[model samples]
Target: MFVIGLTGGIGSGKSTAGEIFAELGVDVIDTDQIARLLTQSGGAAIPAICGLFGDAYITESGALDRQKMRQLIFSDSAHRQKLERLLHPLILDEVSSHVQRSLSQYVIVVVPLLLETGDYDHLIQRVLVIDCDEQLQVTRTMARSRLSAADVKAIMATQVDRQFRLTKADDIVRNNRDFGHLRAQIVRLHHFYLTLAE
Candidate 1:
């Protein structure tokens, strides 16, 4: 299937963009959702994560303690890399399976770290980045995740800067406005992608 890799930094509204595409009948696969599944109770990655990061990172319910893990990764670059090394392959495998079985005209793979990781380069035919102002990103994320402005800034720091992400996009969706504006843009792209899929 032709794959459109949708990416944006935290709080850039990529999830909303993906949902818009999904409403237009496009199949959407989100790596973040897959990652969460893999770290849930009795999940595939729990054993490896426990062995690598120790048991403290695992909740009593046998799921990943995301807050603890997030703090660790943000504090130590090496630990971040280690976590990626463990999760990336598994996530990619699941993504591939979903793409193969999908019946939609084209698949929109929502990968927030598409540029930062570069693992989906060969799998995607087009890169669609959801763009927005940096301050807006920080504000949206702080509200949604209850993170302090500084903590949100720290997460933003780990992602590719806005300018760089824009440069890497094959298509860009400006998301600095209201939902109606975003839906209109997505509706336009839906038609564009349908033609490409043919």
Candidate 2:
């Protein structure tokens, strides 16, 4: 099975492209989703996070306080690295198990920090990058998450820049236009990825 790394800068519409690929029946594993799952009640990473960040990081329902945790990690590089240390290994292992169980002809694993993480590289056969304008990213993220301009820009800074991501891509889907144009890019990329698999 082929593993493709689907990545993009924050608010670059990675989810939109990922969904389109999913509709085309390519197995898609979203790392952000797995990260969220890890913090949910009864998840593998919850205990370690609680132990490190303390019990206060968890809610009465036994869920990680994601907003609080986000602030903690983003503010402190040491804290962020510590969290990644505890979580990345378990995440990769579980993802591998998931892919093994599914036995896909090809799989798309979407990672927002695919470059920054350095946890995966040679593991993926291809790198698919979703491209767009920086100002557009600010606009879309602000519209969706209602984050302050400073906060959005900070998040963008944490990941690899757009040009660097494009430089590393085996494929690129440009998303600097309307929904219809975005959809067309996805349609074409879907066929392209499938053909490579064959």
Residue 168 of model 1 has an lDDT of 90
**Per-residue C-alpha lDDT of model 1 across residues 1-198, encoded as one tens digit per residue:** 899999999999999999988888899999999999999999999999999999999999999999999999999999999999999999999999999999999999999899999899889999999999999999999899999999999999999888999999999999999999999999999999999999
Give the poorly placed runs of model 2, Cα more than 4 Å off: none
What value of lDDT does candidate 1 attain over all alpha carbons?
0.95
TM per prediction: 0.99, 0.95
Worst 10 residues of 2 by lDDT: 96-105
Model 2 C-alpha RMSD to native: 1.3
Each prediction's Cα lDDT score?
Answer: 0.95, 0.85
Best by lDDT: 1
RMSD vs true structure, all candidates = 0.6, 1.3
Give the lowest summed-lDDT range of ten residues in model 1: 17-26
